[model samples]
Target: MKTRYTYGGDEHVYVEVDDEMSLDAFFIGLSLSRLVREANIPGVTEICPANASFEVRFDPDVIAPDEMMARIKELEGEAQAQEKRLDTRIIEIPVFYEDPWTHETLMRFRERHQDPSGTDLDYAARINGYDSVAAFIEAHHSQPWFVSMVGFVSGLPFLYQLVEREKQLEVPKYLRPRTDTPKLTVGYGGCFSCIYSVRGAGGYQMFGITPMPIFDPEQKISYLKDFMVFFRPGDIVKWKPIDRAEYDAITKQVEEGTYAPKIAEVEFDLDAFNKDMTGFNAKLMEALNDA
Candidate 1:
């Protein structure tokens, strides 16, 4: 893929991997960003990798903008030549679908929704060709999702469904941004799923809420003890739909500082996944289950 390099002011260099969003494009950008980080070019301050592009912040006094761009271009070429592999972790996040919290929240913002007559889950189900909400939920948790980017709020992960293009779930954002979204609410917009890390304004369609907290400033949770943020760009997420009882149980454990998210380490190969997505994903899930 051809990359477009541009300047984002005097201190930042922007690299666009592709004109549109795709798993292939995201992986390419990810590869380039990883290579850049590994290279540890002097004067480079920050490396921000997005869905289809990446940006680098640097001090021009230490390394000229032209030289920085050249180094990135070289790394991009190297990224393309190498086999795309990522050492990532698959984490199981339990969600309560159509939970009352998000249901009440969405209902409060009906005037801003595309379909106000029904809940967000119902609207999404109808548009996605699922006969019922249960089927839609089934489709959602059946396949693991890729953490394409981690932003929009600290530790909030933007996820891409790991399915063929035709099978991906797509949803439109709210007509207008909502003044409030419940914390930990699992939201979907434009084929990406995200968990609201904190209670704040949002536009994504609210599906459900997860009991596990992805962000904690106090770093109380065991998994989040090392860092307040729990997710990274390359992490894989598997959704396990749960009922209200289980949700409450997990919530209690979390409050007592006992819950730890289910996670398993695995390596992902883009070429192998492209050849047989089903088989590769199954193996990945098996590893998660075995863990």
Candidate 2:
């Protein structure tokens, strides 16, 4: 893989791991970012890792831009030499597919959708070659997703499916961005899935809503007490579909500050996963279930 190094003004350095996005490129960027962090290079104030690239912020006075780039290049070599494995956590998020909240929002923005006559779910199903909406939803939750990036809103996670490249789900965003998307709305665009942390403007196709809160400024929920943001880069997510009753129950617990997301610690080996995605994911799911 080739990497492109560029300066983001004078205080930040932007590094592109590859010209295009891929799981390989993402892992390389992730590994490089981890190396940068562990190196403890002085003047490096912040590190932001994205899908296929990463950015580093530093004080120009402490570390010259040219020197910072040199250090990162060295770390990049080290990153390439290291094994592609990460100790991460897999989380189970309960979702109510085709839930009424997002349904109402999507209906209001039909004119901006690719297929105005049909619902987003139906349009996605037909385009993806699924016989029914249930099958489409099943395809979504059946495979685990990786948190490729987390942004656009505080604590909003952008997820990429863990299946092979051909099996990945792809959807187009709304023709025009919507003025309102319900909070916790599970949205999909391109090959990524996102949870709208707050009700705001968005362009991704709304699929459903999760009862759990991904972000909370007050940090009132038991799970969120330590940190307002619930997700981090490299985290694995499994979507678990739930009915209205379960949704309501979880919502009640959330309001009472008792809701906690299901999470289990696990190790992810890129090489092993690439060799046998099914077997690896089954093991990951087993860990989640056993926990």
Candidate 3:
């Protein structure tokens, strides 16, 4: 009745695990772990955790849709039977959407984003942290977004794909990319359909930003997709536009790291001891945080 399997390719498969861990637990429980272990096929990853939808990405060629969906159902039934509601709920984050033409405000002053692995945001929040992103998926993580890349472009962090289909939004080059167009100031291609994390040059018409910081350099758990953004691939996001005043106020607070959230924190922990023999390390802290 739950956990449906969707389409994908040999590179990966998308598996959705529902009613699993809470918003906070998987940060440490099972998100980053599986990623640490490379060279493993039929692996998994936690793309994002929305209100009732969690995503796990795998090689569709390797794991069939039925299996992926069945696993999600199995996990849900298991947790429900045990009367244990895993701390896996959607996170609320602030977003600011600006015109792609506003290249002046988009460039990043710094390079190399800080590692959000072990800090206050990561520690304070109840996440299932592991050595790599892969192991976390293998264990307490679910909801596979096949062929998705959890990354930061133009200073913003997101689990995205180089959408080849009719994009949710048109993306194009920034009208005026600064000397330092942040890799994290990520937006959908062509006209930048969806923009997130940090500010960047853009020309696409967009919705207003949410009232939360999408990326944090100082505190850990910066990958806001699961714990904060909680938005994964295939999760339908309805953009609600905000006024200029709201955008200004919210973006200012986020840039200054003084914004506060109005949602309650979630705490869910799961089996995170599963170790992967292969390991993968990222050398690109080049993605700056205080951009």
lDDT of all the models against the reference? 0.93, 0.92, 0.34
Stronger candidate by lDDT (1 vs 2): 1
Model 3 misplaced regions, further than 4 Å: 1-148, 153-155, 158-167, 173-178, 182-186, 190-211, 220-238, 251-291
Once model 3 is optimally superposed onto the true structure by TM-score, how far is the C-alpha of residue 256 displaced, in angstroms? 9.2
lDDT tens readout by residue for model 2, 90-196: 99999999999999999999999999998999988888889999999999999999998888888899999999988888898999999999999999998899999
Candidate 1 local lDDT, 1-291, one digit each (tens): 678999999999999999777878898888899899999999999999998899999999999999999999988778776667789999999999999999999999999999999999999999999999999999999999999999889889999988899999998999999999999999999899999999999999999999999999998887888999999998999999999999999999999989988999999888898899999999999999999
Off by over 4 Å in 1: 60-67
Per-residue CA lDDT of candidate 3, range 24-108, in tens? 2223212322332232325444344322233556655666656654554444433333322233222233333343323233323
Which candidate, 2 or 3, would have the higher TM-score against the true structure?
Answer: 2
TM-score to true structure, per model = 0.92, 0.91, 0.32
The collision pairs in model 2 are none
Worst 10 residues of 2 by lDDT: 76-85
lDDT winner: 1
